[model samples]
Target: MKIKKLIQALPAFVMLTSTGVLANNGYVNFPYPTVISATPSANTQTLSSTEYWEVVRGDELKTGVAISFTGNKSVVLLSPQYSHDMNGQKRAPAVAENAIELHTLQGKASLSATYNRDEMSGYGFAPGSAAVQANKLAGQNATLRLNQKISDDDLYLLHVKESDSPYQLNVESNVMVQEEAALVLHADVTGAKNIKPKLAIQVSAPDGQSIPYHFTNDKLAFDAPLEHVGAREGMYNVVVHSHSMVNGLEVKRSVRLPFVHQRESASVITYSLSEQTAKHVTANVSLNVSQEGRYGVVATLMGYRDGKQIALATSEAAQDFSTSETLPIRFTLPKGATGPYQVNILELKDQTRLQRFVQNELVTQ
Candidate 1:
């Protein structure tokens, strides 16, 4: 009877021990059915500073196997146990506790600008991994150099367990680029999720001239012309897009530049003209110069309509006029010629051709 009692108690002790290990831990499901058969060689696998892991979801079993860090420090059971007596006394064992110590895990550091899920780098820390007793199941890690200074104490890395089964992972980093304020025409050149290797960066101003810029690594810089910088400043959107080869995933970042004010004025010296063909109309046409400040000396002339082209002998401007000075165009008929006609004038203002004509005030037969 003593021997039989001892034998009966053995199963109970094993059950209790197994049940205790199952409590207060996390779980990771692998992709294919993977048995956690071997313990990682402790202190032997010093993973790369940027090493990470990848696995399918729901693949970890609950019983008959377990996995842990090299020193048995952190262990997780993938399977569960079951027992049933002939009298229908069935007792299913509790799920094993996850061995990964949540407190030991660090948050992910900053990520490279090119970081993406399809391209998983080594895992180091995960964002919010600073919590205690959480599993380090996020399949990623990064190794720190022997000599590196970390400034921000609250910073953390980003991580996801195999249970989440993220297609890609991004590890945040500490480095950031500084933005310099300047008046420029900025453009974003990045591919889309459905596109690759073909990105366009272009910016156009109101004057129809392109603003120059430069891009290297992941930083964008403006190299606009010095003269046009004042005119190129304004509201513009810049973007960089990314597309995934697998599953056709797409991502993009768009930046809206604050309104930059630039000083500019019209350069194309232009004017309007009108013509009538039935009566002798004496119309006073005026030409308004657009530019300010004197641009050297220039001659002004008024052109009178005679069929298709204006006869140069019709009229001309006074030599004493200054730049941007508007002059009235006067024309008188040589008595009886017809009942209706048209009038126009051309002024030579600082080597530019300025012309104006009557928009109305035409008497017809």
Candidate 2:
């Protein structure tokens, strides 16, 4: 039910603007339903009643003619009479004229172009060539102007194109995401190998505002504002860190962030240990395994003497354990021992489980 209300409210919700106009400094993010205005209601669908545009004297260039529409309604530029392309062109500049046109529903539409007159000003046009000024002059509120005399072709083109300017947001692609582990501060810790790692991402907005995002399993995403970290069109730093335990001893691993714009994903790795076995006397030796995903654990002890089988004991534990906890395990040595003995520890690699154990060597006195 809430979703329905949100969906229904989307249109008006999008039209809401932060400030009257966008910030002048380069990029400014505006929410949905970017409002566009033109003289004729035909130009701006949002306008009520009839809006008319006239080239009283000099060429009158329209403002906010660029058309963009989000999801539902599309922006339509309706020119009663004009037949040209984006540039100042006409099927008959001497007769029929052309104007700028667009079809997007949302986003800012800039309207401005260099003027031309009869191949004399090195501006004017032929039969079907057109060009609109792409940007606005700083501090000059976008408004119509009649600076010079315009032919019927130029006049008609202005009305036709300016009426319904349709523009589009062409999002090419996002560069690969990258993550890095926190700075390491240990002396004996080493990195793990041959395993996929997990990475945490932090996102911030241009104003330092922070937000949260979710990614699929084994994946992490941060869609918050860039300001979270002093946002702007500059280098933003992302980091990832991982921790686990082996044989009651903790282990850690990490990696640096993405260096290339095309790369963005990374993870930290852990170790694995197999089943353990001891000989002669009972002794607790530490074993370590690396890996954090789903895994299984198994432990066993066997005794052997002079190429002959002897008495033995076994122990096992299975479930889910992360690298963060120390697995305290205890075992007893072989009985009726009179000669040298050996203990063996074996780990089954085919099972779908992460396991690690510590190995210790001891003798009977």
Candidate 3:
């Protein structure tokens, strides 16, 4: 039962990692893995870390993690990012005590960084001679074990680098899962184009059934598309694999990412704008919630004056809704907000089971 629960939460972790690691860079998706036309790639698995803390969210509690690496030379960069709080603040000094122990068949402790309540400079913990000594990895599988000194409640990022590789065989999407009609994807092997990257993609439904794909044969890039299939109200994952060779060596890279499939049972029946008082404009979203749970509505109330784009106010609130009818959200208009306004709904979330966020698109009168 414990293992099952952990597996279920993996999708959220992948989504979070993608948002941070995958740089959109206007159009390009890589420095090492240059993607021509794509959406995102978290990181190449040629060198990977076992951030057991990821399975448990922010806390680094209970049992260390063992990481596995590929490639002839590799080094592990361990550091904790700035910690945040509910009130939107960054914790200072970035104190931590993470221990790294490297092991190969040859010897142990090739490189180690022990942070003991160490005050970090917000960039990273000072790694000493680890990258220089990565030659210890000479064509052998290396394992780096990290034991958290205190993982009760802290967020961290683990950086593992294959220092000598020219290109990383990777896959990516041109969109964030679904874009109106289909999910577009690409196999990026630009750094090592000698491989003539052959790309394959597979999508799985929330129920673990394989969703099919169609070859795009796009003229601009090496890409494909997968239809959005199934509606089981859980998580859907896309598995992409690329096979190629560089410098007479076979190189293969695979990346898997998860996106949520939400049910459209909750919606805005109607919304109206009314000036109820001397201080606020009440923009009421008549919502129809199919499931009983906590719900939130966020919207922007806009009004124009002097024949130009004018004053704006934001409305935000949450309520425990139990199959109710209309819910009213009020926004305090800033000074100089005038007549003939529009209530643009920003987001409506079911903030409960599955937390279905629905964007209500209705033009106000």
RMSD (Cα, Å) of model 2: 27.7
Q: Give the C-alpha miss distance for residue 124 in model 1, angstroms.
A: 26
Judged by lDDT against the true structure, how good is candidate 1? 0.27
> Deviation in angstroms for 73 in model 3?
3.5
> What is the lDDT, from 0 to 100, of the residue 150 in candidate 3?
42
* TM-score against native, each model: 0.18, 0.17, 0.49
- Candidate 2, superposed: residue stretches over 4 Å from native: 1-287, 293-300, 304-311, 318-320, 324-329, 332-335, 338-341, 348-365
Residue range 188-268, candidate 2, lDDT tens digits:
112223323333344443233444666454334454422211111333333333333333222222222321111111111
Clashing pairs in 3: 39-173, 60-151
Q: What does candidate 3's lDDT look like per residue over 175-288, in tens digits? A: 233323454455566466545767666677666777655667521121343333223356667665555655544444555656643444467767787655556677667778
- Residue 329 of candidate 2: its Cα lDDT? 24
Best by TM-score: 3
State, as a TM-score between 0 and 1, how close model 2 is to the true structure.
0.17
